[model samples]
Structure formats: C-alpha cells, structure tokens
Target: MSNRVVQGRMVTPGTLAELIEGSPVLETEDITDADRPCPECDGDVIEVGYMPSVTEFVTGYKCQDCDWSDDDRE
Candidate 1:
C-alpha cells in the first residue's frame, strides 16, 4: 500500500478503517487483478490503498521520468 500527502496532510486520513468498517470485505476480490493506466503519463497504476470513491480502491501511479500522478494529468 502507498501513502499520499498533500500540503503535508493526508488526503483521506483513516480511509482504510472506514473502508473496512463500511464497505463489504468481499469487494476486495473485485480489484485483485485490475490494473488502471495512469491518466497522466500512461504509466502503470500501483495499488495504494482502498478508497471507495475511486473504484472500490484508489491507486497511484507515476511516470518513471516525469513522476506525474493521475491528479497531475494535463
């Protein structure tokens, strides 16, 4: 799992606990083999952690050279 910080604060602190306590545990199976391309640089998305808002899980990806993120997409 990956952790992200914005302005030195977590984007969604305690996201995992909220997911485990709210969403069904079985949902984890749905994303076990999924791979989403980076919306910015078309890099491989790496599993960061669970964030139901973005799928049942939210991922982060970076370009090897540019280090761009999905949010950084132009």
Candidate 2:
C-alpha cells in the first residue's frame, strides 16, 4: 500500500519520505515493509522511495513504533 500507520497517524509515501528527509519531496513511491527493525526501538520499519529534487532519489526507512528514521543517502 501507498499509505501506512506511522506512530499513530496515517501517512502516505510522500509524508513518510518527508519524515526521513526532513522536508517535502517532489515524487514518491509506494510504502513497503522493510526487511529490518528499528535500531532504537526494535520496531517494525517501513520503506519508501522518493525524489527530493529533480536529480536525487532516496530510499527512506521509518519505524512504526517510534520517531526513529533513516535513508539510503547515508
């Protein structure tokens, strides 16, 4: 699905990417379950691919239980 429950609110791929990127993105892909867990909380992690700019595409990861998040840019 393109939408997921993040912490408590329902968020789309764009929103999820924003949570990781710390800003709005230009484009986004569907949200998916990551094959890993949160580092801090050991919670379920979700993945989303987004384009922050015209030339950059990033894969973002977010914990469903807490504020922990990450990106492929690292």
Candidate 3:
C-alpha cells in the first residue's frame, strides 16, 4: 500500500483510517487525494474509505498539514 504523509508523519491506509476514525477499523481502501482544501487551514486534504464497524462504512477526510478531519457518516 502507498503510504502518505500527514502531520509530517508517514501513514499507511489502515493507520490513516484509524487516525481519522479514532479507533481501529475492520477494513480500508487505498488512500487518495481528496482534491479539496482543508476547511481549517487551507492545506491539502486526503481521503480514505473504511469500515469502522461491520455494519458501517465511512468516507473520511483529513488535512495533511494540520489537525483537521471530517467524515461522511450519517
């Protein structure tokens, strides 16, 4: 898997997913560029799709330069 740098640290897909999820995940997709600016600092953003639990899927967004994160979860 291709690892990406976030907050100056290299992180794999699973690690990044956990970073955003605030816990371990069941599964994860490859990391991708979000093609969007960070809402907090205008930095570049990345995206990852993961299963936080068996019954839920979430598309998580996080900043590469700062502590900003969001997710598409209902």
Candidate 4:
C-alpha cells in the first residue's frame, strides 16, 4: 500500500509558522493641523489633502451661515 497526502486534509508545522513569527508594525505621524478659523466667515478650516511632491498641504474652510470657501480665493 502507498501513502498519499490529500490536499485539504494535510497541514504541516510550517503551514502557520509565519503567523507566530511577529505581528505587523505600522508607523504613523501627524503632518498638519486644520483647526484654524476661516477669515471670511469665521468658520472652521479642515484639511482637504496633501501634496507630497511640493511639500504642501491643502486646507479648505467652509462656513455654514455664509457658505464661504477657500476655493474662492484661488
């Protein structure tokens, strides 16, 4: 009689060895602040996005009462 291993019915010790090695590590850093008030309507300024190439972060402010935005300045 010959011994044969079934695909789904077999699991070796190395099958889950990578899981016990270590957990993944992640690093995060705060880049900018968007807590400044809007100059036009005294609204809150929020962070829209960032431009890593130019090293510039874009911020936009929206007013609920006056409907003002920083886009109007550009």
Candidate 5:
C-alpha cells in the first residue's frame, strides 16, 4: 500500500499486514468520524459500515457548519 494519506488523514496503519483483510468498510446512509476530518466538508469522518450488497460505499460526513452531503465512493 502507498504511504499516501487521503486529504491529510492517514489510512489505518499496518492494516493490510494480515493475509485476509477485513471486509471493505462499507459506508451506510451517512456518518462522520469525530476523530478524522472529511476531505470534502473538512468535517469529521465517522466509521460506519454498510451492507455487503450496497451498490456503493457511503459514509456519514457532516460539515462543521455547512450543507455538504456525505461522501460516496462508487
């Protein structure tokens, strides 16, 4: 994996060391992680999981004081 960080936040370190990586972090409706900031809204990037059959990955990311929608990775 690249040592690159998205926007500024780093990906989980040493997370890919294992042979069988965990399931892809599926994004649900929309959530924000208070610890991580959102790249689009600059808000928190909450870790929420979605169903395995979801068409796309969705994560909740509310701007501190803006109307930006969540981030969807299709």
Candidate 6:
C-alpha cells in the first residue's frame, strides 16, 4: 500500500498495522535537543521526559521556569 499527502491531508492507503509498523523510529540522539528559550517566559527549555506510547518513539521537553511544553509540537 502507499500513502500520500495532498494539500496537507494524508491519504491513507493501507491498514493501521501497516502504517504503525512502517513508521520511522527515532532515537534520543536523532531528536533535536531542547535548549531554546521558552515562548511563554524566556525560561530555559530542557528535556524532561519522553512521550509515553506503545513504541515510545519521541522525546518530551518542557521549560525550567514555566509550565510550557513541547508535546504539542511533536
């Protein structure tokens, strides 16, 4: 099966298992470090944890001085 994104919408052409199994896996080193300032308060943003998932594929980051999170960005 094949998947394509047309005009910002993804056209699903396969099963859910196919999509999950075919998805790319990333390591901690492969992800960008959270060192930028937070958008809310100019606080130091740091890597707090990772996204909880069946595969646990992505990193989760937050600010040191504020409650800002990078979860939605992923």
Residue pairs that clash (backbone atoms under 3 angstroms), model 3: none
lDDT by residue for model 1 (1-74), tens: 23434323343324322333354322222212126665665644433233445344543333322334342224
Clashes of 4: 0
Which stretches of candidate 6 lie above 4 Å from their native place?
1-33, 49-51, 72-74
Best by TM-score: 2
- What is the C-alpha local distance difference test score of each model? 0.36, 0.93, 0.94, 0.31, 0.36, 0.42
lDDT of 6 at 56: 65
Q: Residue pairs in steric clash, candidate 5?
A: 27-58, 30-60, 31-60, 32-46, 33-45, 33-46, 38-43
List candidate 4 segments past 4 Å from native.
Answer: 1-33, 50-65, 71-74
Candidate 4 lDDT score relative to the true structure? 0.31
lDDT of 2 by residue, 1-74 (tens): 98999999999888889999998999999999999989999999999999999999999999999999988885
> On TM-score, who's better, 1 or 6?
6
RMSD to native, candidate 1: 9.3
lDDT of 6 by residue, 1-74 (tens): 23333223443322211222344333322123365788998866544223234576444544546546554333
Candidate 3: list runs displaced more than 4 Å: none
Best by lDDT: 3
Stronger candidate by TM-score (2 vs 3): 2
Clashes of each: 0, 0, 0, 0, 7, 0
lDDT of 6 at 2: 33
The residue-by-residue lDDT of candidate 4 on 1-74, one tens digit each, is: 11111222321222211112222212212222346676776654332232222443333333333434442224
